[model samples]
Target: MIELAVIALRGVQYALISLTFGLPAFVLLNRPHLDERALQGLRAQVGWATGAMVVVVPIAILAQTALMAGSWSGALDPQALLVVVTGMGLGVALALRWVAALAEGLLFAFRLKGRGFWFPAVLLGLVSVVTLAWTGHGAATECVGKFIHQGSTAVHAAAAAFWIGALAAFLWLAFRPIEPGSEEEARAAAMLTGFAGSGTVAVAILVATGLVNTAFLVGPSRVLQLPQSLYGGLLILKLGLFVLMLALAALHRFQLAPQMAARSAHALTHLRRSLLVEFVCGGLILALVALLGTLSPPMAM
Candidate 1:
């Protein structure tokens, strides 16, 4: 029950942090393609997310402390909290993450005169993602293995964040009713079309890094027996969702994108709905990841 509560608290953890990183990347990469309205909207959303993350990080640490102490009351113990903050890997990482979050929030709030402060925001965002690598299974490995494992994890996460960010941006752009031939519609199509090359690169990185991550977590000997364990089942479920997302992405690129280019009447509507579904799948993947991170792998058992 206690663990379940922790899992519930962390359900959106990945998505939340990823957005703080991905939103900046999206805004910067596609800034020219976006109108002032879209750019401001993204900046506002990311600012809020960064600020929210400052609060969420503490709550997450407290919840985690409770899980460690086996009760909510122990999480409040000052000595216990100090011990956690002092620890090198996870604790220190969390501290750095919080600082980055704070810095980002402050930068976003202040806003530079002509251009926004996205340059620093993007760098801090990368820092935040790197710190997260310390909190996962990759951090458990030793020596050279630790470097490889954590490195792959960080890249995988960054790629995933970028892909997810693009999907989110597309959804937001298309959510409102778009004029069939307005600049907004063209902008929307351009954003979708522009993502094709980057999306393919992201997929390649995600696939390669994903395989690398899975190998470290579930060794070859344990592969044959994965079907019998809860971890295995959940992993399979995650993989299925990923494949589904790929297929949906293909639909977007080939079918919907073409319709959008041709100025089909319902292109925006259809793309919006499909992006929503794909977004949901991405959410599910993150949730499953939150749960999976807590579970002991079959290889370990």
Candidate 2:
């Protein structure tokens, strides 16, 4: 039960982390050009949503650290407190910047052509990369070869962001309402397809790097045995959810999306439901991630 709970928590943590990074990218990519009202509407929605995340994510971090660190006596352990506070501060700031970059990307994408789009897009991209790199760099526990470790870790983090972000973006755009004879719908559909195609390379990087990192942390023998262990079991559960998400993505990308693009309402409805299911499952997977981060892996124990 403890193992299960830990796994659940880790899943949530990772999922939230993924969401924190990915939501902005998703928002930015889907921003509508040629429509000022739609762009403004998206900006407003993102602003409120990002603001809420900023507030909640830190609280969640504190709650999580307190839980992980267990009881504190009269005087808090300064190092523990510092670590927790700094980590949370860094993460929250990065997350906020990520959202900002996304919003900026949308603004640039819609309003500016050529160089204007390139500048904001480049700025946002660099910020996202740096923030993610920092998050990844923080994962290494040892000081030996810290730079090398951090660099590898950054690659891993970026890969996960790309995969998770692509999946999230695909889910978001594919499910939204599509009206027949509406240019908005057609453009959205085109964007969905284009984005999905672009995301495929990111997905590949995510999977490959993830495997490498997992291999480094857990040897092949233990990796095979992970499902029997507490942390392993939870990891497996998250993997299952990921697979389900992928399946839904495939359905939408290959089957439903094209059908909807062809003006099939029935296909569009199915795509929406499928994407919603994937999103729910993604949430569950994230909860498990939160738990996983708190648990001791078999090797560590």
- Whose TM-score is greatest here? 1
Task: Give the runs in model 1 whose Cα sits over 4 Å from its true position.
Answer: 113-116
- Which parts of model 2 are misplaced by more than 4 Å? 1-20, 27-34, 57-140, 143-149, 162-177
lDDT of 1 at 20: 85
Name the 10 consecutive residues with the lowest summed lDDT in model 1.
Answer: 108-117
Which lDDT tens digits does candidate 1 get at residues 1-301? 6788778656666787778888778777788788777877877777777878898888877877777788999999987787787864777777888899998887856765224577777888889888778988888878898999999999998998878877777777788667886778777777777778888999999999998988888987788788899999999999999999999999988888778877888888888889999999999998998899889887568
- Model 1 scores a C-alpha lDDT of 0.82
Error of 2 at 107 (Å): 11
Count clashing residue pairs per candidate.
Answer: 0, 21
RMSD over all Cα atoms, model 1? 1.5
lDDT of 2 at 31: 56
